[model samples]
Target: MVIRISKGSILILCLVLTNCKDSNKKLKETTVVSNIEKTLNFNLESAIADCQTQLERAVPKLTDLTKHPRFIEKEDTDWHQVPNDKLMWTSGFYPGILWYAYDVTGDNKWKKEAIKRTEVFEDFKNITEHHDIGFMMFPAYGNGFKIGDKKEYKDILLTSANSLATRFNPNVGTIKSWSNKMHPRWKQHITIIDNMLNLELLFWSAKNGGNPVHYDMAVKHAETTMNNHFREDLTSWHVIEYDSINGKVLNRHTKQGFADDSRWSRGQAWGVYGYTMVYKETKDKKFLDFAKKLADKYISLLPEDMIPAWDFDVQSDPKEEKDASAAAVVASALIDLSSFVESKEEQVKYLNAGIKMLNSLSSKKYSGVGKSDAFLLHSTGAKSLGWEIDVALIYADYYYIEALSRLKKLEKK
Candidate 1:
């Protein structure tokens, strides 16, 4: 067939060809970027060694082992240690970091320091006014037992789990995260998403010869939080208030996010970590499914660097500050979650996502290294409360080291 094309039609064909060429270039560029991300080198041993060096410098500065180091403010050169008499929720993290260091290096000196720091929380097992006994004891005594299998450490962990159980009201179906005195505005029995992490102690203790009731309480709390603490999209609220008498959700709010409905980065991390752990302990498919949903939502919303801002819904500004602590928690949790998933595809995706996060954390941009004694930098702790913004938090260091240790074990396997 002989056909004559008009000038306009010829122009249209040329434009279409140009657009196709542009699209092909973009596709090639994207593929290269994806390949680069997949092949990014993450030296787990070097990262752990860097952490050990940081800890070696930090331990000497902590002259009083009784007072745990908490954070280093952006403007300060020294750490703000938790007061000796005060029962801080973060008291166990310092010891936990030491324990992880010992695990990674198998150095007797790290073990000795870890034991000294772990013993400081032995009396914390009896603290019953709050739900943080898990935070205070598990990382200290729980890790101690896990490493050395000491009878004393096991006993302390059991006692700590029991104390945590006392805060669980049968009527509320969740443990009280804060006492009335702790937050006067939260007169109703308040439970924070962070409470999910404390359930691990109960689950472990129940399996290790404590009251089986501890297991039931942990499951009940997980179920209640699973039902009430999450939005339809699966992002979590930092706090949920409940009616103490009848087990009803009274209000959903946030203490550390941009607003009441905003997704706090650390709170979501807690959900991912907590649900993953709950599924591991219970072997319930429902919990595992919920954990995947939580992790998926979190992974979906992370920034390009794999680190998240303090609040996911916060105004998008380059200087808005990132939460390395949240990244660390999610990294550790994702590594554990990777093992639980049945599909190999899902396993590799989660595991690679976790390693990518750890790689970002290990970089000099987020790593404390020579800048501070803490292991990681730029962690936001309760930014809405104007506290610990852009600081190196003890918990961030704890989880970073924990993630590294977990990754090391996976490499061996």
Candidate 2:
């Protein structure tokens, strides 16, 4: 297949080249790619080929020859791209999936597609309204930096970290997750369990520039979340409403889960992934222990196939929609956490658990192979709200690919 880059994309290419430091600019522009063998002993060559075909099919539908994909809009059961701006939290994962594909398959096709998609986010580095800049920047630009060694990636990520840091209210001891335009049920200062995952962007910024405040704020937010977000049973509240003025805990409720008290399966995944990631970056034992408890609870609660219903308390039917995205996140976190455990038994337990989740996701029923949807399957995105339910969420695809990449690296050890 011929590589297609329009004349307009050439401008984006030049801008991408010039934005970063000249000395640090490196792009591995190569068409030859050797296939990477999966170390988890999972045969993903066929699956990845399916992903490549779907993505290639998806590219022709682009209205803007320059910009890459937004999330697929479901017209009934079919998924197709509808244009949207960069105001969404899942924006980065599209390019992120491409980057991971590049890393795993060494395919220049994925790299080129990823770079084009990444260029669209150049203006978003300065956005500060929400705490999701990390979600928007890091996986796309961060992977670009890692793959290409571009100074542009570093600069954008640092700026995004600063943008994320701006949301940190010291009085509340946490970063506000949403803008004021969120659901009216939320307080002005609502710190969510998912925000725990964004601290990595701040921590990355602090490490590179020696910014002490970024580090301090991330630590404080983790502490605050540790103190407030969890139930006694170790599951998480989706959102914790706070008094913005005095840092008082006003009420703990959910904006995304099934009910105020129901366990949102994805939120549980965030708790495990975020705490595990924070612990990985900080070496904080408390966070690691906390992550373990949440992961264990999640594992114990999983239905026989290891897939979780969107919310544990919301659905009783075995056929209810499941959040495979959350399952993927937990699988990726467990893979990382396995490396950190002191006990060999626990390590094997976590590792095997991750492999089990991956096996489930990769199965024919859920993998969405040869499906017209053009994304992975069995992902329940806010099923209770009737939004993106039982669809292939891009974030789920990102973390699923990420898990495979992490597994590939670990298998080498």
User: Which candidate gets the maximum TM-score versus the true structure?
Assistant: 1
Off by over 4 Å in 1: 1-38
Q: Relative to the unseen true structure, what is the C-alpha lDDT of residue 25 in candidate 1, on a scale of 0 to 100?
A: 63
Model 2 C-alpha lDDT per residue in residues 1-413, reported as the tens digit of each score: 99999998999898877776453322211100111223444555555666666666665555363344433444332444534355677778888888988887888878887888887888888888888888888888988888745666787888788888889999999999887676677747988898988998888888888366998999999999999999899888998988999998988888779888889999999999999999998998998898899899999999888888999886577677888899999989998898788876787688778878887888787775666545467777776677877777789878988887877666554
Worst 10 residues of 2 by lDDT: 26-35
As a TM-score, model 1 comes out at: 0.90
lDDT of 1 by residue, 1-413 (tens): 99999999999999999999998865654443244345877777789899889988888888796688989998665688877553589999888888899999998898898888888667788989888888888888888888756667777788888889889999989999988787887888999999999999999999999999999999999999998999999999988999999988888998889999898999999999999999999999999999999999999999889999999987377788899999999999998887789876787788889989998999989988888888899999988899999999999999999998887676555
Measured with C-alpha atoms, the lDDT of residue 294 in candidate 1 is: 94
Best by lDDT: 1
